[model samples]
Target: MMKIMLVDDDRTMQAILKTLLEMDKHQVVLWDGTSESDIFAQIVQEMPDLILLDYYLRDRNGIEIVKQLRQEPQTSHIRVIMTSGQYLRDECLEAGADAFLLKPYMPDELLRLLHQVQQNG
Candidate 1:
């Protein structure tokens, strides 16, 4: 099972994703999207196998975050899957996400992508 860190601001979405991921036998680590908590630090501490990053966060931009992650040597190789309600797949990929999922995507799609990323990694 992969350790997946979920970075999203919506509580309902968080709950739904946590349930879905847990059911798939993957460990889920929820980030509250608080600006006070250093994102990089949490990522390093968790050492998650993958990161599910939401595009439009409350305080920070997920695209920028992904760009930074790719730039950092310690975090560059970590797989990231970006999600957004808008059609920002190209931007997300350019920012270094392993994959992009549009919002309201089916649970099966997410799980499929998760496994696909693992396989490709």
Candidate 2:
């Protein structure tokens, strides 16, 4: 099973994602990385298999977080899947995200991306 972290400010989205991922047998960690230190600590310590980062946080963007993750050797290699309500694939990928998912996507779509990441990487 994959260990996935969902970084989103929306509690509803977090709950839905947790349910979906858990139903698929993957572990989920719901955190927005609100405090810079929290995300850094969690990523380095927990080292989840994947990070489902929202494109826009209340205070920051996922690309910034992803960039930070890439800087740390311990977290650099972890696959990060960025989700966005808008089309920001280029920007997210440029910042080192492994994959991009548009918002309002189906659970099957998310699973398909996860499977692709696992197979390719």
Candidate 3:
């Protein structure tokens, strides 16, 4: 099974995604709130197979986070999927997200994306 890390400030989103991903048999680690520094550090320790991040983080911008992640040799190869209710599709892609998923996505779509990431990884 693939290990996924969910980084979002909204508790509801984190919960919903966690449930959906878990149902698909993926191991999920969830992080909520605005502590990017701590959260990134934790991610380094956990080293999940994939990362699903919100476009707007409470502490730092999602683009910045992605850049930082890509800069680190250890975490650079991790697949990152960015989701947002506000950003445009191209914006997410341009920001270095491997995949851009809109908010309130269907479970099936999420599953497909996860599977694709797993397969590609």
Candidate 4:
């Protein structure tokens, strides 16, 4: 099972993602905050297989988060999937997200992406 980290400000979304990922037999770690320093630290320490980040955060933007993650050598190789309810697909891709998922995504899509990452990684 892949270890996944989810970062979103919405509790409902976090809960839903946790349920879906766990049902798929993947381990999940969730955070509702947007402190880049803290989150980056955790990512380096845990070294999860994938990271699902929300486009909109309470403290910082997803683009900035992606940029920071990419800039760090330790976390740069981590697969990042950015999710948003409002942003365009190209924007997330341009900001360095490996994949983009719109809000209200199907569980199958998430699982498929996870599988693709696992295979490619």
Best candidate, TM-score-wise? 1
Model 3 stretches astray by more than 4 angstroms:
32-34
What digit string (tens of lDDT, one per residue) describes model 1 on residues 6-72?
Answer: 9888889999999999999999999856662488788888888899999988778898888888999
Ranking by TM-score: 1, 2, 3, 4
TM-score of 4: 0.89
Question: Model 2: number of clashes?
Answer: 0
Stretch of 10 with least lDDT, candidate 4: 31-40
Lowest-scoring 10 consecutive residues by lDDT in candidate 2? 31-40
TM-score of 3: 0.91
Model 1: what TM-score?
0.95
Q: Write the per-residue lDDT of candidate 2 for residues 1-121, one digit (tens) a residue.
A: 9899888888899999899999999988877546845776877777899989998887778888999999988889899999998999999999999999998899999999999997777
Superposed Cα RMSD, model 3: 1.5
Better of 1 and 3 by TM-score: 1
Q: Please identify model 2 stretches exceeding 4 Å from their true place.
A: 32-37
lDDT of 4 by residue, 4-111 (tens): 999887888889999999999989998736565587777777888899988888767788888888898888888889888875679889878888888778889888
lDDT of candidate 3 over 21-94, digit per residue (tens): 89888899987465777878888988999999888887676788888888899989989998888756787777
TM-score of each: 0.95, 0.93, 0.91, 0.89
Cα lDDT, all candidates: 0.91, 0.88, 0.84, 0.84
Residue 68 error for model 4, in Å?
0.8
